[model samples]
Target: MSNPADLGVSSLVLQTAEGGDINPVYLGIFVVYLLLVLAIGAWAYLETDDVNDFWVYGKRLGPWLATWSYVANFVSAVSVIGFIGAVYGDGYSIMTGIIFGLMLGVSGLYFVVHKVRELNHVTFPDIIAELTGTEVARPIAGFVLLANAWVYLIMQLVGAGLLVTVITGVPYEYMIWVIGGVFILYTVLGGLVSVAWTDLVQGTLMVATVAVALVYITLDLGGIVTINQQFAALDSGYVAPLGDGTYTGLAVLASIVAFFGTIFTSQATIIRINATDSIRTAKIHLAAAGVILAVFYTMLIMLGAGTTVALTDAGLTVDNVDMAFPVLITEYVPTTIGTVIIVAILSGILSTTDTRLHACGVTTARDIYDYFTGGEASDEKLMRVSRLSTIGFGIAATAIAVNPPGTIIGLYEWRAVLLTSALLIPVYVALYSRDTPGKAVLLSIILGTAFGPGWEAFGAPFGAPPTFMGVGMALIGLTIGHLVLKGQKETPAETAVGND
Candidate 1:
């Protein structure tokens, strides 16, 4: 391939009246893919008759579907776009977070899922409430879950906007609405059933696309050894274990802990676990997804490095590292192949977006609305509220996304670490300690939640992450609250409603 700037006019579409063109064929492929997604959403809507089906996919997922869905949900725009961009901008050391974070994080989830499924809960709040035996815990956890979802949703929309704008030559502000609307439509219509099934398809496509892209790029550049030699020739640091000193040892460690916290406790992921047909199935598929994600993330990080090397060789320059993958595909690959890569990027973005939407809806309907409304609302009415909440949340995310807060990785890390700190300890107590009181659980969440943001506001004392302080505060609060309320009668563990 020669300079992408020299590709024939017909191979690209006009980006603006005054300048470059985008490939129409690429846009055509994108349109077709979205239509297929809409069709799937319609099918899911017809299948969903109640809140459980909407929220948990009727708990009937097989191992393969579960595995793919889990991977898809885990590798969202954050992994493919944000983290990959960081790898390109930084280096190999950036990869440590996925390596350490996911290995430990997903391992913990294996234990957590069995307990989660045994609880037979529909949302994160249900898990906390069931164990703590407090109605107030439901809405409090719900609010935290909603806050997490809201920030996460904004992150997805921002990534989507970046992708669509770069690929289609449209402005990001216009692109976010289109992206948000599509997510809202599918999620509002069909809920988690729609999200899970579509994830299977999106996951497969993304993996296949990356595999093809990697193989092609490697072969085109001569081979792995040659690519490494070329990178060393450009800059020895490009191949260094700790690239450019951007990610210090402490930063990597904190990222690992934070990633672990996020994956194990994210409501979107918890719901994916709940969607499994059985606890055994959830464990098998989740573990498989972890291994698969580790591999995919490794490749994605390399892909970023590969893009940088290729661009350096081609004499191309990107203003932002986040733009590297998109620019690489559009400039270096054939239009048809580039189209597939574009869809792959969209697949990563949309997979996470839909699940976040479902999570917000479930939190709103089950945890906040229904719990506060005395739990007597009709299924039909609750389902209606769920649908409305999905749309509402989508709109809110889009509004916030119109002005992106920051880099996808930065914003995601800030919010995820906080949620993990606030939610993880309370959940651990609920699942394992039958003697802990609701008051203690509630106080722990409050203290943990407060400590995370407060520590960050205080400049992250000792260079320690909020996760350490937050979880530590939560444990301390838990012990004190338990000691203070030790004489209260213990609540019997509640039985889950359904079985495999």
Candidate 2:
């Protein structure tokens, strides 16, 4: 699952009149896009020769391919749909969370991320194990990766199923199977090679479609000045810096911490960094993706405000924020462009879903499985295991998606908290503080999960985002472990990532 698009935190539903005829155009676009993606999977099967190719696409990534894959894998309905939905409620404050938090994560990453490339690793666990010099790092980081990927997969599947169900008028239950089955199939057959190339296609279309939607909305509502006036007319705070205080400063700060965790530690990031052909390409691609995301998100402001104005003029009000953009598309936008928006939304979801699902495969075959193998697993044998694991996790995630757990934001939070709380700092430490004891790394992870997600599970007693406490404790654990465990233990040897 790419993202529930948490677009703010709900399934996207485009409301229509009773007995509305299903649009053949949407069905055609959706079907054609899926076939093309599946075909890429088939081709990648040929490109993949061993586990090395399966995991990091043979490290042959260039600037454009990496840039497209990077952005597409990160963007989901949440960015296009959920974010626009967020604008409906919080207004400009939401922009700070997206623009400031994510942009900083990407831009700041440029400084230190090259070292990640230099590591010559495969999955996230590989890096952690290498940097921490501990065997325990693999299983611990592996489990967290699965947890993150599992929840994230369900998030994308639900969003994707809803998209197909609503657009094609397929039952949600049936759409879940169709969408879930196909993503699992492609991911297993192709691995990162297929995933990366498909992301390029998905990413380009995602940007173009949203850009079109934002442009149409802007013109239809007579531009940003007119859109601002319309929203200001709705409420002065809509144009105010804070946007009605739906999300306070504390909330924004917490979100940034959450964003940082995901950026620093997620498998999606590790593979992208390592997959690059050169460190320079990784830097350039990441910088480019950052700028593109900035522009794309800035357009979300217009998509939200402009759509509000357009939909209001049409005498429609969507109580569900997730429905706002979809309603805007079906009712206000031209038919051709509307179909493109629907297709892109689904494509965006799959683009992200495939990336996350691939992470699950890495966690299983590379992370957990490798621990048992002790770095001696044959390349062909490990490749088979990766494929088997991909299929297994895909089926599991799809089954869960058919009956997803919790609300959208709650589900997406699991994806963030586990990795962010546990691995974010450890990842950086491994990069910069290589001398930090293995015990310190392990404790940082343990306390981070305890304070972040463990705290969240207990209802977050402090009434703040879990990242605040989780990361706080993570830092404490790191410092304490360093002071206590330093020189008391001999660090384990660094085992090279075997399949590579």
Against the true structure, whose lDDT is highest?
1
Tens-place lDDT digits, model 1, residues 222-321: 8877877776677666677656665566666766776777776788887888888999998999889988887887678767767778888888876555
Off by over 4 Å in 2: 1-21, 491-499
Estimate, for each residue in 53-154, the C-alpha lDDT of model 2 and write its tens digit: 888888889999999999998787567666676677656666666557677778778888788878777777887877777877888888877888888888
Residue 101 lDDT (model 1): 78
Model 2 lDDT vs. the true structure?
0.77
Q: How good is model 2 by TM-score?
A: 0.93
The reply for model 1, stretches above 4 Å from the true place, is 1-22, 232-240, 490-500
- Model 1: residue 72 alpha-carbon error in angstroms: 1.2
Q: Candidate 1 local accuracy as lDDT?
A: 0.77
Error of 2 at 262 (Å): 1.2
